[model samples]
Target: MITKEKILERVGGEEYLIRHLVPTFSSKVRKKNYKSIFSEKDDKPSMSIYKERGVWKFKSFNTGHQGDVFRMWADYYGLDCRTQFKELLELIDQEMCLGLNAERKSIVTPKSIFPNSPTVKDPAASFPSQTLRIEYMSDYESFISRLYLKYWLQYGIDQSVLEKFDVKQVSFLSYTANSGRCLSFKYFEKHQVVSAYHISGRVKVYIPEIAFSFSSDPYFKGQKKSFSYKNQNKDDVFGLVQLPEGNLDYILFTAGEKDCMSAYAHGFSNVISLQSEHQMPSEDLLRVLRSKTSVLLCCYDNDEAGKNASKKLRDSFGIVSVQLPEDVKDIAEYFQRYTPNDFQLLLGYGVQQVQSITVNPIDTHRVRRLSNTKRSKVKSYLSNKFNFRLNVVTQEREMSTKRNPGLWEKINVNELRDNLDRHGFECNLDLINCILKSFFVERFNPIEAYFLTFEGNEFDDGKDYIRRLAHYVHLKDPTPFNTRYWYIHLKKWMIRAIRTVFEPEGINKHALILCSPKENIGKSYFCEFLCPLSLIRYYNSNPVISNEKDAQKSLIRNFIINLDELHQLRSNAHVIKTWLSQRYVNIRLPYQEDEITASRIASFLGSTNDVEFLRSDLGHSRWISFEVESIEYIDDEAKYILEKSWEQAYHLYKLNPGSGELSKEELLELSQRSDQFTTKSTEAELMVQYLTPSTKELGEFMTATDILRYLQEIVGITIRLNTKLVGTSLREAGFDRVMHSDIKRYGYFVQKGLI
Candidate 1:
């Protein structure tokens, strides 16, 4: 009898036992985490097992229970302690007995867990004696009957090829004195049969009714199935044993064993086949081919599934596809009709034809013309006329304006060369270089290309520009404000917008927040007018800006990040603040493995219908607010004014690019005036409604719990409120607190005052 320690040592370790047993216990397992959530229909193991220290441990998250590998096995089978131990011993003994071979002569531990271990001698002696049995025959008549030989000859395979591969007929179950015969193909590893496939000769009505059985079948006999006796190192590629042992010039890959045999009969001795079309060749087989062969040719059947598999193999290993004649379906069928010499000639002609047309000719002048036209248009539009840039940061966002194709069309050298060759033009490197130099401008600093031009008209003066823009803005939202207030802010915004295209330097960066409690107030339209619709990146709602990584991803390729109909931004207000203040940020693209430090070229602009959008800590300096009160539809007159205003602003911006800055006193005063438009939190508004300035003399004290109860019960507020949130809002609204002791608990004393 083997002790527990001896059993563990003989089977390598607990990890080996679990690895070999997991598939038998669970149907589905996640490769990344090795976690399996089993179904209740069968006795499945619902847990994740992993190696800890020197032992294997498992934990079931569903039940919050943990144990070792032995316990897991017992739990899975509902076995008692004595029976479980007996079964474990039998498993180890079976593995050691089957694994014993003449070459190694012992079962060595796996290299991953135990690197240094002295080999135990005579492992086969520890279990019941057994031997592998193979019934060899002398010739075809003695091996398979004449009927079997005829059946195989129908597929164009001769008896000599079958005898060379050692095919035989065997019987598994018998009903009469003479048992029914089935063809058996032994799968060999190191010249020893590890498994045998038994193909039945019984005919069926359906095309897929060819039944087969394996020596490794679990239900072959009424006995407990164990994986320990199975072949641990089976070859993925079938028919590998028949190939000659030397370097091969080429290897033909087929989809089935019969096809491989047919190819060999057709004088292609160096051929291998996958078990099925879906089963790709293993990496080890591919590596051998790469070392010994120069070319790999896939000869799959001429069906949709076969063609798809051929393409998959081609993509994986850069192998070439060998096309058969349209009349023939596969290698076996082709061999039946044509001679071996004829097929060889056909393959040679195909290879020569492919080599002759290796490089395609191109039209150099056409590519040069397309590149030049695109580049000239972009430069003239940005430098002279007003053209907008539209930056798409994510797929979920839909921009209101069309994307500018000219700005994004960059020239690729390799693509240009290929196009030239296809169009029959001789490729000239010097000519391509000249064209590229004319179109592409290199920037020394990241801030060189700061602004994208708005596609609009030119204006005469700043005053006329402001009036036309104000009329256009008024057409969208007719809420009238002080004339001077509207003029100064509108003028400042236009200057900033124009500068974004020209000289975007030496300015305090603040995100423009266009907010109002009402909807359809033309806030988004106003932003569109200030910058080109093409140059703006639009987000329908607030993005989850939880960390600097998220911020970098969102702001990498845009000039203006526009948020529309934003309702709330309480969670990541600080991250947004950092994004607004930094002139440079670290960016990492999805495809790139490393991060790149680049200048922050994009500005933030957000429109919201929520009155309580910002948290208390988001200071007013990083944001500029404008309230849109009412909206009106644009008529012909307003449209004309808008067009003329855009023309005026375009000319004004070109004449004087750097003109959008306010004095410190003016900025401070503007901030104070904008504060009136700031949104107040619900708690802050409640404090203002309930507390009076004269109530400070009353000097009332209340516990946080009592205050919470009053807010929830008396006020009938449905939202869950905690003391931390309440206190934060009250403090932002300018309320002072003092410590107070009650009979039951200590609380806070608050002097009521209007905020």
Candidate 2:
């Protein structure tokens, strides 16, 4: 019972065996280039050894000879690796004193083979594999290794079939044995040492890379087993992941992974394996698979164990067994012996045809008039078979349509009808609607769903956004402008604007206004570009606030509202402020039964040519005004910066929900800065010139009417005699109103200046 796994453990590892058996013919083994050890006339050094996925391998450019340590040993001795693999293992054990065979006591010295070389032994040979421990390790290439793929291709499992099932080509794989030995294998054309079998579950099965007829080989006589597994998981069902979505007319269950792949190679896509014939599928798995296919059939190997297991499954779960011909061992062999069409013919004879299960045959004209009882039965059947639900955020109906189930996709009415027709249920649009009404429906908040779709790189701490903003837009705030201060506030405003799309309470009460006297500076384009390309449909450039109904509808549908002409809104500053301050809009939408309140997700951005866009002094805080020197058109770099800024803002918002909100100090600073954008207030200017703050001991109190009378008479100024304007101007000049109880009115406490 001496095996290669046990001998490899005793000899440290395969790497040691390669260094000992194969000597450097031209130069030292540590050099980059070495003479070919297999050829006598290899005058040029063209062979070199390299490690791939922890397995030591060598390649010869001169002769195109390449393989792992075991393959190299076989090539050096001029032996066929497939038939004489047992001899290869025995030779290594005899050379390394591995003690695999107690009867073999003689050990050969390396100096005898290579006469000019010294017999040096590595001290750490016993634990060489431990130096690079590969536990649950694997690597994938674009295609399966050509050498390993060549073996399976014989059974008709081509590249497309393997790729469809996600069966990857393992470049190299290493695993630890139960005896604490780490064994690694690499795939090469010269001789593939191991095979990698990828199934649906978490198991990784490795077998002999090349299948050999062991009847003539004395070492492997009477032995058919060739499997060594590593990193096996709880899931036993193989090929389940490769099943197509929705219920199939029929699905064939095979005995092993190879057989399952072989069935798929041939047009049988709906096929799976339970790892072995004896291992019955779990009850829950069987129930799920039964719902996914109309008919389930089993095709095991042509042997006693396979037949007994097939019968047991048929008796217990009522699975139909497709017995193979006595000459063929399994489906893989059957496909090799006969054509795919032959196998298809055999399947029809072995498995019974699936019969329709409908209680009544419907006439084409009466499809719409199906009885309530029959319709209810169809609905119940669909509900029990598949999970159907509606995504309120995406506004689409979807059903669990995956082969293994649990994967949902948008429902296509026509596709559903076709699938139903195949199942013996004559369905129409009306009937399908009736059946869908019974499906579970649920709603989700659109705002949360919209923001959750962002998946990309986030900018660093908003500084990148502030830098880009400073480079693009310049604020006309007073002389000696603090670029850092204004840009930081603008960045905060941008983040808050983004949050406005997710928050329904309308936390952002301001609109970003870009002003420039020159025309066509890309101002409008920048405003439009503020909305991400993914949500470009939700960006409204031609916004009309005059129509209250249309405005409310826009608030619900659009995420970004571009106020095109900012100066035109100056006439309706009061109304604009009222509209901007609304948290939710209550309006009757088209087709809506009655008035319904809708949460607003729109954040406003505007562009105007007029420098003096702010006409009202009271609503200046609601507009973040900036005079742009220039705005560049949308490009790749600009798009990246804008996208990353939103991503970063979202990241910060999720981490700190209130990160976008301004503090009390910031609000006060913003209010002070907003004054520079406001138009010159003539009334406030005249009031400040005519009035002064009262001293603590000496002051006179006057009403707004009295102040207006003094400005028209005493100051000799022609002005409108409006008491409310006079009172507002006085307050704007830093005057506090005093409640005159004696006079039953409110007046300001001030003393007249030089006037």
Off by over 4 Å in 2: 1-450, 455-466, 474-481, 714-718
Top-lDDT candidate index: 2
Report the Cα lDDT for residue 132, model 2.
Answer: 29
Query: Each candidate: what lDDT?
Result: 0.50, 0.63
Per TM-score, the best of the predicted structures is 2
TM-score (C-alpha, index-matched) for candidate 1: 0.36
Assess candidate 2 and give its lDDT. Answer: 0.63
lDDT string, candidate 1, 71-152, tens digits: 6644443334354566545434544332222122233221111123222222222211112122322233522234345545
Specify the poorest-scoring 10-residue window by lDDT in model 2. Answer: 122-131
Residues 405-502, model 2: lDDT tens digits = 66777788788888778888886788786455332333334455556766444446636654674456544542345566656656676677666765
